[model samples]
Target: MLGLIGIVMSSEDPNNTDQKTRLEMLNDSVIKLDSFIEDILNYSRNTRMGVVMEEINFEEILEEIRNGHKFMEGANKLKPLVEIIQKEKFISDKKRIIVILNNIISNAIKYRDTSKEESFVSVFVECDSKKAVITIEDNGIGIADDKQEKVFDMFYRATKLSNGSGLGMYIVKETLEKLDGIITLESSLNKGTKFSIQIPNQTN
Candidate 1:
């Protein structure tokens, strides 16, 4: 799909207004399809395998996630603060963790509050010998009070802004359960959303 996007973009003519609009639409469609396929693959991989216990490098993981999203459209408009206050040997399923973080970060960019003067997404990780505490917060178009509980259900979508495969959070919840982790959500409509996560270090 990305290859297709590149081909479509390269063929665009600067003088053709309708062609530019159509090209943008085509590009967006392919991107969404690519995302949906990736989401499905992630879900399948998590369910098929056992959690691999390994030491997770918080700083490296955060940097990788940041770089992955930098090419996204609204990502540049948002002020992002990602910090690791304390990091020790935090062991968990690295693949599952990346899937979880990627889905959450992707949503932050997708559902940004266009009405606001500025948008922001913050991620902080604190870890000890036993567990890791991760907080992902974003000032975006937040989940509604009524839809919060269903966000982790299969094929459920909380916001209309969702162009996702609807399996992202469901996969997150499933993966957390496999790792004996806990996740809590707090949000106000049109205000913002925050996810607080506590995952035990399997090395113990």
Candidate 2:
């Protein structure tokens, strides 16, 4: 009886309980911090690596981007709808182009309203003889006017709670600028954000 009583007292000790709970919480936080670091590394690698330009089919790129988001939604048990309007093909780095679309659309889906079942994302592409324009728009929560520019800054999260490294738009900006392209954003809080990139067909 005394042995059993001693074990019970040891288990019920306030210091031991507090220490066990603290360790568990710290372990969970460490796991989360590790994940955060990995994400940062991946984002940095994507931005730092350069690709060679080639004949890239705009439709195919759109499809690839759509398929990627679809897979993500499926994994997260969410339904994603993607719409694309393409007018022409552009000559650019296929991988880089895919990166731009994928990152932006992923963020859109990530920020989508979880309370709503009919959430969807849209992508549009247009082109002329000189420049090709790609636009990605989402129906999720939008960015504030003042935060629009900050969205393209490295590690700048428009909202701290957002599930992104904040490097998506920054990478997009760098990649487009490398291709002599420009990105513009039009957004309003609660309305959604639209990112449009215009790249020259020929770098002369």
Candidate 3:
């Protein structure tokens, strides 16, 4: 529908300012819709595929995620602090880990409290022989205590502030479950949110 509108509007007289403005708006909507569809596809693909674990570097993955967000609209205003407390390689699905990190980071940026003096997202990783523990903290608009539990539910939008499909966290939880991992959340309204995740050091 949006595409058809855009095509029709494109044929309007070039001098018709009103038509041109509407066409531009429709084009932007189409771009956003395309992105939303791609995210849903990625979520579905991750859930259907079996986990493929291999030795992977924790820091390298974090750097890639950070670099990917450099061009995002408000990325510069939000500080992304990444720290690997214990440098260790783990056997895990690298792609899924990327998906998990990307979703969390994306949320941190999307839901940031612009009223604050500054906003930041911090990632900490601690790994031992048995498992790797990751803590992702974001100084964003925190989830209300009442809505915290539903954040992982499919299609649940915790806040009206979101323009996304609300499947990011759901995909995160599903992907983690497939790897026998656990995730927990903590937040205080108006302050921030923290996610503690644990994945096995070795998976069968």
Model 2 C-alpha lDDT per residue in residues 103-203, reported as the tens digit of each score: 78777877776666566677767766578777777767788888887888988888755655566677777767777788889988877778888878763
- List where candidate 1 sits over 4 angstroms from the true fold: 7-11
Cα lDDT for residue 84, model 3? 88
Q: Which number leads on TM-score? A: 1
The TM-scores, one per candidate, come to 0.94, 0.70, 0.85
- Answer with 1 or 2, whichever has the higher lDDT: 1
Please report how far candidate 3 places residue 186 from its true position, in Å: 0.4
What is the C-alpha lDDT profile of model 3 across 107-204, one tens digit per residue?
89888999999999999998877789999999899999999999999889999988778788998998898878999999999999999999998833
C-alpha lDDT of candidate 2 relative to the true structure:
0.68
lDDT of 1 by residue, 1-204 (tens): 666767877876778889878878888887888888887888888889988988898888878888999888799998888888664778898988888888898889999999999999999999998889999999999999899999899999887777878998998898888889989999999899999999998776
**Which candidate, 2 or 3, has the higher TM-score?**
3
lDDT (0-100) at residue 200 of candidate 2?
84
- Candidates ranked by TM-score: 1, 3, 2
Q: How large an RMSD does model 1 have?
A: 1.5
Better of 1 and 3 by lDDT: 1
For each candidate, the alpha-carbon lDDT, in order, equals 0.87, 0.68, 0.86
**Which 10 consecutive residues of model 1 have the lowest summed lDDT?**
1-10
Model 1's TM-score against the true structure: 0.94
